[model samples]
Target: MGSTSPPATAKCSSDWFAHKKKNGRISRCPIWGDIGEKQNAVDFEHSFLRAMRASNIEKKDFILEFQLYLTHGSPANDWYIAAAAAASDWDAFAAAFWVKFPAPKVQVRMPMEYEWILTELRLDEAKLLEHHPDTNNYMWKCNEQANWKDFTNTIKAVKKQEIEEGVEHQKLLEKTKAEVAAVQKGLWECIPPMPETPSKALGHSLAGMGFADNSRGRYGRDQRGGYAGRGNYRGRGGGPGQRNSTPLTSEKVATLAWNVALLPHHPNTSEGLQAYWEQLAAWAGRWGREAVINHEKPVLLKPGMSPVASGECFNCGMRGHQGQFCEAMGDQTLGFREREWRVLCGHNLPHSSGHSAQVNNVLDDDFDTWLSGGLGKGEGSTD
Candidate 1:
């Protein structure tokens, strides 16, 4: 991980700030590509030394080889060549090289639009937590291309330009800050249970229709359905807070349980909605339990899924089941077997025998002859 040191007398390549060319074509350095104002002399030195060491070249040979790549016509270039010639050791040469060619600082031009500031420059907590590659790349590019001082100045210039262009970067900053705060709050706070949902209301109403709650004081009544908390089945006490004297039929209870189980707009949060559903199920007893079982595990349909022959019937608007399994048909509940009859026979016949066609007769020799006019009737008979 530590940077490899080269001989102090070694000179960096002439094309270090500029990309090198091979066969008259620009060539990318094996480590860094497209060197621009972003790269400085020190970066070239480190990269060149690492590459030379990796190639197993000796210090003396590396110094001689590096001297060959020094750019001409510059006073710094002249100093580098002279330093390499007069150097006593690798350390002395390297020290001279850096003193003569310290990395020059550069500034990057900012884009006209301010939106990229939020997207490219501003830190995003979500992206940071996710360890996004884009975020890493942006940070690396800023550091490698421009120093912190130059980058900060560029950001200031960008802000001024944005205000002059009426881009509202400040408003965007405020909005982003608010969203971050809200997300943090949601993460730290304990989630509260949702208010009474429609399903809960329906479940309560069903319980009131005479479903006895052995665990609680009589469900809809204050421990009594009549006067003086007792004996009479119906009386002045049989109002909103009073228990109903008439018990719900099994059919009514089953229907109500289904309705409660299928109620939409349950809370979007998983824990809250689950608690609400469990409470509703407990109140309705066995029927509610069945509803919960049938509704919870829904068939997931998505694009590119394998083609299926038949599934739960969507026509019936049920979940965890598909349209093909639907039982509805003009005031009658039809099972899969019953539905198959309509598909294969075109109608619901009283019996399979109602077809009125005899397969045995149709297969008889006489019937075949009658239909074919005795053509080729007998193999031995030419007629």
Candidate 2:
């Protein structure tokens, strides 16, 4: 900004100007430090020299008028500069003045978008300047010294950094949107069917029933995935021909079939099963029921007795078993329901998809009033 106050010294006599009027008067600006605006020292010096040429001012004249040019608050009024001014040598005084005040620096401003970022950085301005480009210029102590050159470069780098980070933020926003969309689609699926849109056919990218893949990836004890009920897979999975894990030759099959056909049926219980085995051993039939059971004495386990008694090997159908000598049972195992099937059929039948599911159904669906020992069914039941 230019100075508001006019110079104390009036313009010099116009004899020189009148002489130049024959050639036209020289155009001029106010004396730089007096009436002229103080933008920079360079412009000040130029205007000073031009004013000197226009006035035929002697070498000593500037030193004399220099005091009139300076305001009361000017740096030239300092003790050192004032002492130099007392000397009549204009050159020495100018040199001393120049030393006290270096040339004014150019101004630079940061972009508005990064103004907040710069302000935040200045919260710890020391840290912000730690990675400065002009640290080697130790002569300059602050940004005012570096002004538009090194300082400007540093801000440019910061703007580039902000732009790069903004791109990453955009990418993260897109990822978050996709995740939110997926959650919305899943919540929409939980809503009940509407008459207008009977099925939410957004497509089955997710793993569930009624999806595009028709994939029932989710399965648990709820029978969500089609599976044989408990104690199931007995007839067909991982067994000899079917549920009969021990492979029998045609001769063993023939021998076992005839004898099993003549055997008496037994109720499906611990006591009934034990009695049926004892009864088979004493049948007095020419056909052998089981070679091991027939040859060895039958073990009669009374009710409430320990099942760990020395007797038949459930795993190998052998007596007084030595595990190394006895054959291992194949994959199939007989639980309570499987034993009932065996007792009724005489032999394990191969599972066929065409056959109906029988006794082994959902819990309590197959059992009825026959036992009726549960909550309200029995005599001890609460009314």
What is the clash count for each candidate, in the order shown? 13, 2
Residue ranges of candidate 1 with Cα displaced over 4 Å: 1-39, 74-76, 104-383
Q: Per-residue lDDT of 227-272 in model 2, one digit per residue for the tens?
A: 5322322222211112234444555555545544444445558767
Which candidate's lDDT is highest?
2
User: In candidate 1, what are the lDDT values of residues 1-383, reduced to their tens digit?
Assistant: 54344335443444432322322222224212123434467777776676566545568756655644455454545666677788887888878776755667676657755566667787654433332222311233243223456655666766666666565766787778678656745653554543778565443323222212331113323434332322221211111122223434556545534543353333436655465445443333323322332222222122121111111122221222222222333323332322221122111111111111122222322543465675666644554
For model 2, the stretches where C-alpha displacement exceeds 4 angstroms are 1-38, 72-84, 106-383
RMSD of each: 26.7, 31.6
Prediction 2 global C-alpha lDDT: 0.40
